[model samples]
Target chain A: GAGVSQTPSNKVTEKGKYVELRCDPISGHTALYWYRQSLGQGPEFLIYFQGTGAADDSGLPNDRFFAVRPEGSVSTLKIQRTERGDSAVYLCASSNRPYNEQFFGPGTRLTVL
Target chain B: AQRVTQPEKLLSVFKGAPVELKCNYSYSGSPELFWYVQYSRQRLQLLLRHISRESIKGFTADLNKGETSFHLKKPFAQEEDSAMYYCALYGSGGYQKVTFGTGTKLQVIP
Candidate 1:
């Protein structure tokens, strides 16, 4: 019973660089979500995927942020031209269904210098 | 737009004292509310959902639709209760969008 897991627990990159954060949800989880949490703030939802399609991506801050969960399993959050403001923890969560309790990953700490 | 608000950023209480965390949300349709807690060095996990109506770890939250609030309460706080608590809201919209409030840090002093 592996829970959600995010790779590159800590990542550091220069401003204007591109970075990607990956997440592996629990087996059999059909719903996956991405969120970003800034210091001293709550997680801000980025996007959600049901099966293979993104159900909602309104939380994405700007055009530079994008995510995909193809084949309905692993997900990746990509940031183009990362900015200093993008320094935060990128969290991923998954659940068996939309209404079920979600399980979260440890989160990837992304730092844009 | 739907929003969840946690008014207090931090709350400290002595051991055995009563504890309460306030949460308020705004949504037009029926909403699903949940309390998620994250202990030191641990991933965020669900504590309880309003739909279940069952207390977990001596903590209970009553959803007051009229007040548009869901407040978590525990009669006797313990040192282990120290953690960050987040109130989440899920609207009835088709996308199943979920929103979390700015968490509240609970400090239980022994």
Candidate 2:
């Protein structure tokens, strides 16, 4: 079975640039989540989508970060005016249900210079 | 506020030695706890969950409600067990968001 996958295993960009990270969740998964993991730190929750609508976005650090899953299958996390502080691995996960075990992707490492 | 804590950031042990990784969580409601592991060049995966109460790969964790702890233990460590481990919590709150603790890197020396 195909698992969750993220595009651009590595992305390097200059500060103030815009970038988009894409995630393809497993087929039939209804729940998707985004997380950011800094060096030597655990993954921090960013946002969650139960379907087409975002069920939780409180973990989003600021307005510059936005994510959308319009089709409830593919998701994209967009960052505006990237900053050095945003350099980290952006992880994506999906599950069949809200409480089901999440399957994680390899994650896209975003490096802001 | 709900939080998961893995106090140890690094743990090293010799093969065949007993191992224990401590984890404590704080949540107002009954939280579902889990241990996730990531091997070298591998994506994070579930090692075990408290609700299942079953051991996986010679690892077991006992959730203690009174102490608010779920410590992972194995009678004898193996070199293949080396990996990064994270403790996570899923509260009953809206969205059922999962919070992970700073991971612990375990090194098993053969």
Candidate 3:
């Protein structure tokens, strides 16, 4: 079975620029999650989507960060006016249910120059 | 708020030696504890969960509510076990977010 996949394994952009990271979750997965991992740190929760609607987005640092999982399978994490502090590995995961074991994808490394 | 703590950033042990990776967590309500492992060049994968009560790849973790700890342990270490380990806590509260620790890097010396 195909696991979760993320597009643009690595992306480098200038500060104040905009970037969007895409995620393809496993088929039939109803739960999607986004996380950011900085150097020497673990992955921090960013947002969560149940089906096409976001169930928990409190982890989003600020309004500049937004995510959408329309159609309930694919998700995109959008960052507006990116700051150098936003540079990190963005991870995406999916699960069958809310509390089930999550399957993670190869993270997309975003570097804000 | 929920928090996970991995006291050691790195743990080096020789092959065939016993291994223990400590993890402690703090949460207001009952939480689901998990251990995630990332091998070199591999994505993070679930190693085990406290609720399963099953060992994976010779690794096992026991959850202690009184101590608020879920420590991963194994009787014998293998070189393949060298990787990054993250302890996570998922609280089923209103937010339903999973909190992760900084992670521990395990180095197995041959």
TM-score of each: 0.98, 0.98, 0.98
Q: Superposing all C-alpha atoms, what RMSD in Å does each candidate have to the true structure?
A: 0.7, 0.8, 0.7
Measured on C-alpha atoms, candidate 3 has an lDDT of: 0.95
Candidate 1 structure quality by residue, lDDT tens digits, B55-88 = 9999999999999999999999999999999999
For model 2, which pairs clash? none
* DockQ values, each candidate: 0.86, 0.78, 0.82
Instruction: List clashing residue pairs in candidate 1.
Output: none
Candidate 3 Cα misplacement greater than 4 A, ranges = none
lDDT of 3 by residue, A1-113 (tens): 99999998999999999999999999999999999999999999988899999999989999999999879999999999999999999999999998789999999999999
User: Predicted candidate 2: what Cα RMSD to the true structure?
Assistant: 0.8
- Give me candidate 3's TM-score against the actual structure: 0.98
The digit string of per-residue lDDT tens for model 2 on A23-73 reads: 999999999999999999998999999999899898999999999999999
TM (chain A) per model: 0.98, 0.99, 0.98
